[model samples]
Target: MNEIVTTRLKPVSANLSRHKGVRRHAAIFIAPALAVYLLIVIAPSIGTLWISFTKWKGIGDEAKFVGIDNYKQLWNNDTFRGSFGRTLTLLIAGGFVVFLFAFIFTMLIREMRSKKLIRAIVFFPNVVPPVALAIAWGVLLAPRNGLLNEFLELVGLTSQTRTWLGPDLLFRSIIAGLVWIYTGFFVTILMAGVDRIPAYYYEAAELEGASARQKFTRVTLPLTWDVLSVAAVLWVILAIKTFEFIYAFGGSGTDPSASSWTLPVHVYVVALGNRSPILALGQGSAIAVVMVALVGALIFLTRRVMRRAVVEF
Candidate 1:
């Protein structure tokens, strides 16, 4: 009887094992997307990082291994260094202006009677294409006959009516142009964050007789911090990779006279300009590598420093 029972159980165990195998096969089918991501996204990013360690002219057959030479050039090259400096300046100044405007606009809209209309108007700039926004800004800030200069001249402030895109005002003008183009997007982001906060928090603070400033400082700031940090990261990345607004508004190509060139422009000037193909490719790739490193470091550090504390709300 025992031998017969063991023989009957063997077939049942085999079928159960086959079912487990089928489940494992299904799991494998489900994993193809992740595998593709590892190959496509993760692999390429790692490859670019490796290329940065090499002196690969963009069209080269073989990359010359030059560990840290590209980084060294970034530190020593005046033009590259200057562009990096301008990038940092924009990151801080432009980033702050966008954040401030976004925050104020979002708050004001929330308090408005016609909130939807106000929100739509505020977000209008974001709907406009970046290139068109750039062109419009160029017209507005044009040195001689710009709307700004015209207004300044009317006020008898002739000194302030000077060239907006000239070397002296190039950086600030670019910052302002970028702020105009980007503040709307930031405002929309902040508004979404603001919408998530519980109204009860404000009500409780109001009942406590908290001044407006105190309420903002104690209640609003901390609660909104997580979203604001996300916005900051986005702004930081945009500032580092600022190409469109500067390229379009500052001038079509690298303006030798304009002080607004950032790293992307620097890379274009070095790699794609009418200069010798070899030098252009070499220096361009080098600059590209450095820009990647700088931006990567910033993002990493930012994530480390500003990683949001999880809130129960």
Candidate 2:
């Protein structure tokens, strides 16, 4: 009877093993998404990298594999170099200026009697279309009839008037416009962080004879460091990827000397424009890969530099 019972249990054990095998099969179903990701994002990236090693002019029945020539050309391309320098300038100016404005706005909003109206006004620019902002800015900065130059003329500072959209002034104007549109977003994010901090801390600091500036420097800044660091990284990426506003404001394609070109604009001019017969698929890919590396490095360094343990209140 015991032998018979043992024999009866074997089939039950086999069925349990078969059920586990079915669960494993179900987990394999996750492969479809992974496969799609590889095809759409990974495969394209790999193709671009391969093309960068070739001298393919965007469209032809045949592509010649010219190893490292595209990269060598990039090093000597003055146009690409200029745009790269401007990109750096935008990151520094835009990143710091926006953060400063956002910090001040958040502070002022905390003490305001009517917060909603102020917030709506400040953030209104963010909702406006980019094309609209570019157009409005163009009107405001027109040398002959722009509001800014006109005001200067009224103040007997007519000598100071210059074409704000001229080649010399285009980059600065673009930076200013971006700052105006982007500062409010950072302000809103920061205000949320500020709101989370306990008011009792400020109250305690006040009782301890701390000035408003001291309280902000000692308490507020430290508490908000993580959020600010995140904003900085985001701004850096935005500045590097800046394209639409530049193109919308300045006519697209490579200019006489690429005066207002950023890296993205450079890619468009080389890869898509009819004026340049050079197919920049490879170079564009290289630029994109380099950009990704640069951003990744910056984020890693910032996290290291801004390292702080989260404070629980």
Candidate 3:
């Protein structure tokens, strides 16, 4: 009896020792990455949080502890309010339009013989520098002698030609440009998800007399819910941080109008724009903190809303 007990104990002890050795090796491999993350991401975030509570210009100025006054000022600033509202518009309305067009394009090109070429054309804008795209858009929408206005005149619809970059229309134009830029990227993602779905599922549905719309609703959408959720989260982050496109869209050598500013642009305007003599680094930090918080909250809400049972194939 004693010899049998010792034989079983030996294997158990060896297995436990091997498991510990594997964990030790894993920890060794993870240490460098963990250290870098703490140094780069965690450290800066904490510093920014600290700076948000103080009033400070850029280097050479002493930081004054203000106890949330920066946030209070931000709350009262009309320009900040407008920028925040525009940011939300870009996040919500822009996301809706982008996904809408992405779905449409994906459905259209999914079965096309020339789908690769079409996809490459659509995704070309994403590879181009956003600043360059914005400049091109600005030229196209210029109040006079612009290509769009010229085309309108040629088509005998001169009345439809107005200053596309005017204050009344600049934000709308930016939103439209954003939709055009991002739709292709989302289409690529959704197309990948759609492609993974077995063709037999659609065949099965068709045999049951399912129409095109019905197949899409009952088959495609359900299988791709996880991908769509991730894409939505990615859009939220991208939309909030958008800056260069809007900044350059206003034309060179001058700041964009306050009406077109998003939160990221607002941070630049507050902390470093030529319009201000002294930088409001503290206020900018406050804005950054708010943006981080907003991103976190929205991501949490999105995950909650999109949570569903895994539909395994």
Candidate 4:
């Protein structure tokens, strides 16, 4: 009887030891990722929040507590206000155009021969560095010697060869470029969603004598909605990260005109592009804090609005 009890205790002890070993290895694996996330993301964000409430030059100067002065300044400034408005236009107006073109192209290309090649061509812009594309955009619209201007001149539509880079049209030009760059990514996402849809749905719709538009509305739209929701969230995130295109937009070494400035560009302009450089670290940090808050709120709102009952086949 004593031998039997000893053997049972041995297995129990081994099981407990195994459980402890598993937990130890799990911590060992998770430790590095947690450390990096805290150091790189969370720590910097917290530091920025603190810096926003103070007047620090981000260098050797000591931070001076200013309470809410930076926030007030940011609000009172007309340029900052305009920059935020432009940011919204980019997020909403540009988003609408991107999704519209993406859906149209997805439908057109889905039935075409050589679709793989067409898809590759459409997706090429996303793969290229946005800086290169932006520079190319500037050259293509370069006031007088631009490709479009030259074409208009060649075609005797010389009156239409207006200054594309001037203040009047610069902001719209930026929006158009953004729409073009982002549309491809959404197209790919939407097409993948379309692919997952069963062909039987379409066949049944056809047997019912459903019109083309009817099939799209009754079948395609409902089935692919889950993907659309995900795509919408991604678009908001991508639109917020619209710095590189706008930064490289005004050509090399030139500051973007006030009309074309978005929130991210405004942040950089305040922090580094000032004639008295490094003077407004606190102000810039405040702008950054606002951007963070807005992004979080919009993402939450978008997720809520886009939520739908899952339509699994």
Candidate 5:
């Protein structure tokens, strides 16, 4: 009877052990990451949203529910409007300059002799810290004593050496700096997109008597359309979050001037950034939430606009 019972149990045990047990173990493997994400990302985002509706001083005080009072203030504030407008200008104007130069650079460097070296040189700015880039440019554009103005003076263009950091030109300078820093990165991305086109496409275009511009329009642009779409989406996201470049202006606890302030700077100034008596914690949190929403909507719109049937090789 005991031997018969053992033989029966062996078959049941073998059946249970037939599989490698990945399904049962997968939950255990993923649980840690899920826990971290919930704690860090989800919890903080929820907390921020909650804070957006409250009047807490970012201290150990109980939050007072103030409804949309913060948002009302922001809506009326001229400073906020200018900041938002600057962000838009950066997104549109800066984007155009970055893309235009990036495309030109991609086309030019693709056919150059030392293309790899040039590529690395172009990509160096993307790796540099945003603050450092801003500081370096700021020094070069300093009104009274800058390398650019000095050079202009040396070249007998003394009258042209105006204040680059003044109110009239400060925003333009920032936009231009953004273009310079980002152009290389987009160029690299576009080069990768264009490189994937097999040489035979160009050969066919040539056989059909296609001009240089015609080849670009017909073969290169069509094939790399997907990459261009992706690059535009990425650009919009990065441009929206532009903080460090403008924030570097206000070093240490000092806030950037109204003229130089971007949305992120505005958000920072409202929260804990105030040197005044009252800290508008709710207002800053609301601004951040609005920005998050804006970025999401733009990303969704970008995907919708750029969506197309895949052109597989």
Candidate 6:
């Protein structure tokens, strides 16, 4: 009985030692990545939070503590309020439009014979530099000799031609351009989710005399809910940080007009004093803090709203 007990204990001890060795190796591999994240992401986030409570010119001058004053001033600033409102609009309305078109394109492409080529074409714009795209849009929408206005005149719809890049329509044009640029990206993601679905599910739905819309509503949507939720969160982050395209679209060499400014652009203008008389690095930091909070709250709410029981195959 003693010999048998010793034999069993030997194997158990060996297995435990092996498991510990595996964990140690894993930690060794993860340490470098963890250190990099701490250095770049975590450290800067803490610095930004600290800076939000102080006044500084971001160069030469020392920072002076001013408790909540930056936040209070930002709250009362009309420019900041407008930028915040525009940011929200882009996150919500732009997300809706992007997802709507993505779903439509995904449905169409799923049944097409040349889907791979079509997807490449659709995704091409996304890979192009945003600055170039914005410049192209500006050229197409220029008031006098723009391509769009020229097309309108060629079609004998000259009356429909207007100054698309002017103050009256600039914001709308920017929104439309963003939708066009991002729709393909979401389509690629949604299509990936859709492709993972088993064909037999659709076949089974068809045997029950289901229509195309019924199959999509009952089968496709449920299985892809997880992917859609993640994509929505990604859109929120991207929309909030969008600056280059809008900046290039509206500005020649100076800051864009206030009507088209979003939160990121507002942060830049405040912190860098681009065409502005004064730089307010602390106020810009406050805006950054607000943006971080907004992202966290929206992500939490999105997860809550989109949560559902996983649909097993």
What TM-score does candidate 3 get on C-alpha atoms? 0.91
What is the TM-score (0 to 1) of candidate 5?
Answer: 0.88
Candidate 3 — number of clashing residue pairs?
A: 0
TM-score of each: 0.80, 0.83, 0.91, 0.90, 0.88, 0.91
The candidate with the higher lDDT, 4 or 5, is 4
Off by over 4 Å in 5: 1-20, 250-253, 274-278
Could you give candidate 3's per-residue lDDT for residues 1-313 as a string of tens digits? 9999987778765676678577788789899999999999999999989999999986888999999999999999998899899999999999999999999999899889999898888888889998889988877888898989999999999999988988999999999998889998999889989999998998999999999999989999999999999998999899999788888886454677787899988888788886553488899999999999999999999999999996999
Candidate number with the higher lDDT (4 or 6): 6
Report the CA-based lDDT of candidate 5 relative to the real structure. 0.86
Per-model lDDT: 0.77, 0.79, 0.89, 0.87, 0.86, 0.90
Candidate 1 or 3, higher TM-score? 3
Candidate 6, position 285, lDDT: 91
Residue 297 error for model 6, in Å?
0.9
The residue-by-residue lDDT of candidate 2 on 173-276, one tens digit each, is 88898888888888888887888889998999999999979998988988887787787777767777867777766663333337877877777777775465
Q: What is the lDDT of residue 223 in candidate 4?
A: 94
Which candidate would rank higher by TM-score, 1 or 2? 2
Kindly indicate the candidate among 5 and 6 with the higher TM-score: 6
Question: On residues 1-313, what C-alpha lDDT tens digit does candidate 5 reach at each position?
Answer: 9999987778765766666895677678899999999999989888889889888886887889999887887799898889889988999999999999988998888778998899889889899998889888888888878989999999999999988888999889888888888888998999999999998998999999999899989888889989999999999999989888877854433677889888888888777674652467787888888888888898899889888976888
**What tens digits encode model 6's per-residue C-alpha lDDT throughout 77-172?**
999999999899899998899999999999999989998898888888899988899988988899988999999999999999998987778888
Instruction: Give the runs in model 2 whose Cα sits over 4 Å from its true position.
Output: 1-37, 252-257, 274-278
Error of 4 at 37 (Å): 1.6
Put the candidates in lDDT order, highest first: 6, 3, 4, 5, 2, 1
Q: By TM-score, is 2 or 5 better? A: 5
Estimate the TM-score for candidate 1.
0.80
By summed lDDT, the worst window of 10 consecutive residues in model 2 runs over 248-257
